[model samples]
Target: MSERVMPGHTDGLITLGAADALWVDLTTDSAVPTASGAFTSSPAQARMGYVLLGGHAVATVRAGDGRWSVSEGEVRRAAAALNAVGMDRQDLVRIGPFRGAPRQECDEEAPLRWRRRITGELGGPERAARREVGRPYHLAGIDWRQILVEQTRDGTHRTWWLPRAVVRLLDAAEHAETQARDAGDRQTTNPEGPTATPRPYNKELEGQLYSVLSRKPGTSRRVAGWACAVCRGAPATVLDHCHEHGYVRAPLCQSCNTLERPDHLYSNDIRVANRYTRLFHTDTDDWLRHWHRCPGCRARTTLPLPHLAAWTAHIACRSLRPTHRAPRGRKPCGVLRVSWTGSQNAPRSGLLTVAVDCCPSGEHRVLAQVPYREAAERFRIWLAETAPALAAAAGPDPLDGLPAQSRPVIADTSGEGLALF
Candidate 1:
């Protein structure tokens, strides 16, 4: 067999025939150098013949002749060897002569292995064609071998048929890209003054604004006004740097700004309370509670309070509570008396009462007259079971609605009120 060496960063594409089958000698130090060609070539005549002798890289071989095919197992082995050599699956781009042959067992196992090796490397796999042929050494000197391979990157222009309106929108996006580039260039160059610092642009703010507009909620002027409100200033002159960095001072109202004080927002006590409440509501709370410590004050006094009336109402509606009407005949079967005691100094003051009667001879009967507190405990148990189901039925859980990383944590503790609770 004759051998040749072509050296460069550019891809080497060699065409081989039956008699011109390339014998790849990878044992040499310079055969497949770390910086040079890290690939191999062989002919797929009557049998697929390509040996990965020795190299710290992957080898891709395609059949030149249409007589032989490459099996998926071969591709998988090649990929595995490459991976062992510290090369990622993505490093092996393509392998194949990809000529023509009769249809046979495509041996999809290889491609699947390739997928497993390179799962999530890209979004997913693309569609491609395959062929099969005969060879001398098919798995130990057989007559035929199955060859399966796909193109790494084809320069095929994929034309997307779009509606005229969509085409117009795409044209608008192209124009926007051009305008953005021009704006960026302008921002970089201080052409007007000699020593003036170029104003830094906020890409995040621009993106956020773009997101709002893409919804097409209202007119540009109205949207601009809302953006200004968010910025807490004239939208045109508002330097967006602070807003982009999550500085709450930008778009909030004065009241909200005051409410979101440094002491209040980042307080360890508040963070711990919030986290405790969140944990109390989630199924993962059991696991998270062990590791859940306030990063702010490093305190562990946080507790979940039933402050949300709406949630309480939801719990009450789902519980087996009695109706408003009293029973007709007085029967000493069982009585469920519920009463609410209000604190005198509480913001909201009210007394609530509920009574349930049990039927003596009927299938349904009350067990005992339990305290409202006990009933509340029972409600909590029911919530622990049914809240998730109710959340599922209502749509997504509120906790799930939070961004993956924005689950909240105290970043610092430098205040007097840094207690966890």
Candidate 2:
């Protein structure tokens, strides 16, 4: 043991032998001081040893021969000096000279005191090994002074320098772990977790299947089936659940999952519409009109119309649409005729027209005209059949001003003589 170093002790650097360890004696006024200081001799040394003198002090240690002095106002300068000499928190080993205060007093004041000292002496919590101990000191009316020791290794001899690369990797790993822990904490605290349990269906498996299909873009049913079986999901369009667990898996295609429901199936319907739209490079509106239905409400209304324009823009940028061509024998359906009549002798009808000049070569030209009411009915039926599971899953419709069993239909009819049924 050596005599305690005073506040204005002479600044000096020294090297320790292989069998010897450097020691520091720190003295301060209170156990929780506002400022502190440390000293080291060599810039290369990474570890140090510390001892408490008369007064109490909080101390951090590292491996090094460098010497430093810290106090209420000079703690930051001392730490900066150590950093300027290439010494960091990882180089520290132990801290001492602390007269432990009562747990209540420490709990209230130690954090604030520690935070300030850390800011000045250790940079932050990341750089130091922290400890608090109650030990008797010779000095009177003084609580403690902060002291630090660092360590490094050389060959078989333990010294105080930590490799910079190791320090960096450890820091990164610590950061990643901290982020993951934070995410887990948030998940646990979320109110929705208690009320809305995630439909446990193996997202990783689904992602794997998505990866396979996304790679080929147009894989066959057999290939898709094999992949789906391995991935544990339904095919690419229909919704499947674990029969034993009721957990919803990824959807299968309509051709693959033939189950139908009397009500709307929201999830399956959305999946099917989105899937076929991706496959055909067609707009969501087109997919919904030709294939999709609402499972929540069993509605055949243009489900994708709201998102159609955005989807179109996205797919267009991807160059997914086919080139336009002229029809072989008929023209293109470019014009639509709508008629409305309020008289008893006349009826209302809407007719769509085809322009023969714009028809694609070798393609058949057929005019597709339907009554608004009929279209609506077809859409409802499509929804009930395509996404039966979704309909069941939804339990009940949430929309306002709509019946649970029926949906409104649109009628498209020409204003002609009102003689026919």
Best by TM-score: 2
Can you write out model 1's per-residue Cα lDDT over 48-73, one digit (the tens) per residue? 12222121111224444544322223
How high is each candidate's TM-score?
A: 0.15, 0.19
Candidate 2, superposed: residue stretches over 4 Å from native: 1-181, 184-359, 362-366, 381-421
Q: Output the lDDT of residue 309, model 2.
A: 19
* Per-model lDDT: 0.25, 0.26
Task: After the best TM-score superposition of candidate 2, give how far the Cα of residue 384 lies from its true spot, in angstroms.
Answer: 5.6
Name the weakest run of 10 consecutive residues (lDDT summed) in model 2: 261-270
- Reference-based TM-score, model 2: 0.19
